[model samples]
Target: MARPIWSGTLSFGLLNIPVSLMSGERRTDISFRMLDARDNTPIRYERVNADSGEEVAWKDIVKAFEYDKGSYVVLEPEDIRSAAPESHDAIEVEAFVQASQIDPRYFEKPYVLVPAKKAEKGYVLLREALSATGRIGIARVVIRTREHLCAVMPHGDALLLLMMRYPQELVDIDEYRIPEGKGADYRITAREQAFSEQLIETMSGDWDPTQYQDEFRERLQQVIRRRMKDKGVVRREDEEPELHENAATNVVDFMSLLQQSIARKRRTPAQASATGSDAPQSDGPAKKAAKKVTAKPAPKASTKAAKAAAEKAAGAASKRASRSDSSPAKPARKAVTKKRGKVA
Candidate 1:
């Protein structure tokens, strides 16, 4: 079992459920270590005094807060501890908001909530109540000496505690350069909308996750594997062909294109049927005539040579079986003779 990083109680109104928080995720990425180019060895860093250019020991270092340029204030551990927020060891729920009301942008790191000793009943009750109500609990928790806004939501049979971003952390959308709601009115027409709907209907199908795959990632891994094996790798440069010489002159004929596409699809089945069958009778009259034009004489094999090879194989197999059968009989006779000798 994995150990929890945090232990705390969830408090809302009169209810309290003791729970522990376990880290839920890990990142696996290729990384590089800082190394010296001359020696090809790892490089180490040291805290040093910038002005004196002397390395400072850990015990000699003190935390400082810079108030103004070239001016600083040193703070002791006790002073920082006094200014810290109260660690209540509890996740206090402030509100029960609709899950859809919350913007997805505010979500952050996730953690698994596990019931501590003697807290199983309360944990299950909270999980079931949240699942039944279809709402998430907005709460505040102090983890690692820092206060964090969090959401406690039911995921399957257990609770998922997720850290949330503060409202101040979100950037205001109004500051960005975005299109005003004017030009869109002239672009969309009733007929164009109907054609788009028809196109969507033709493409609509069931959502099967198994049908979708990361083809680029698979190809990338193949390339990497080939490189590792010291094989020559060929990289293809793919470029999109130019759509049109000029936008104004290139007008689309939607109905004509659709008709041509349907015709091409119909021709495909006919072409497939013509090439698939091996029997001469399966092809139509025109195909049969073409087949006669392309036909070649069958290659001949000597009947005597084939017969000799088949007889040799059969004889070798028969001899092997006969030897195996006689060897087993010899062992049986030896056993019988030993039994008679003992009896006599």
Candidate 2:
């Protein structure tokens, strides 16, 4: 089971419903890390003192507000804690309004509200009432440290808490120079409008999101798989120093170590040092046995040989793409025929 992000009470008038907030979205984007291209070593980011260029420990760090140019007001942990909302564990509903009254733009992220143990009665009551009346409860909820304006509404069988943007955060539509009049004002003839409508009507279908896919991501994944199969991947070894639990208390000769580190030239890990031999490390006994039986360790290839192999893979990918492009697509999904409007 997925862990709940927050456990809180949902408050409205005199009623209180104990609930847990669960994330409603999944992140599927491929993440890339910055690396030193010269040696293919992963880059490290550190918190360093700007003036001294010395790394600062996390325990020594303090929050500060920059009130003016080159001026700051340091705030302690106690100071920040004091400023936090008094009832941080409650999603207090201020008012109930018609769902239509809220603009689509105001909705940001969504979180599903799950009823706590033995709290299903109140949860069901709110969801049913919201669904019947077509109303959403405007609530103020504190998730983590920041307070957010949210809407608690009936989403199928559950109550979904959708984070909302503040009024000031939204830009007025009057700021843009949008067309004020109908198609006639833009010199569009009735025949053009009719043709456009006809085109739209012919292409329209049910909104089945599963039918659509992130084409770019899929294509990128295919390319990556092809490259991994042909060129293989470098197995990176972690080299980060493990600090003791009480890092502050652990005494060490830091100045000497810093000087030594600065003087030394960083090199690639042993596994990746030999170019073109990037076979993945076997993690399981079955994989180890398979590696031993099927493939021998690749000998370091010449620069010319590596280039030729890369070119071959590129050519194969290009042919596959060409075949895909020539294949017929569903009429509704792709433009099968172009209908031109009559020139008036």
How does each model score on lDDT? 0.75, 0.76
Give the per-residue lDDT of model 1 (tens digit) for 93-158: 999988999999999999999998999999998889888999999999887657899999999988
Per-candidate TM-score against the hidden true structure: 0.61, 0.64
Per-candidate clashes come to: 0, 0
Which stretches of candidate 1 lie above 4 Å from their native place?
A: 182-186, 191-344
> Which predicted model would earn the best lDDT?
2
Residue-wise lDDT of candidate 2 within 227-317, one digit each (tens)? Answer: 7887976444578774333232226443343333333323245635654333343224556776776664333334444555555545555
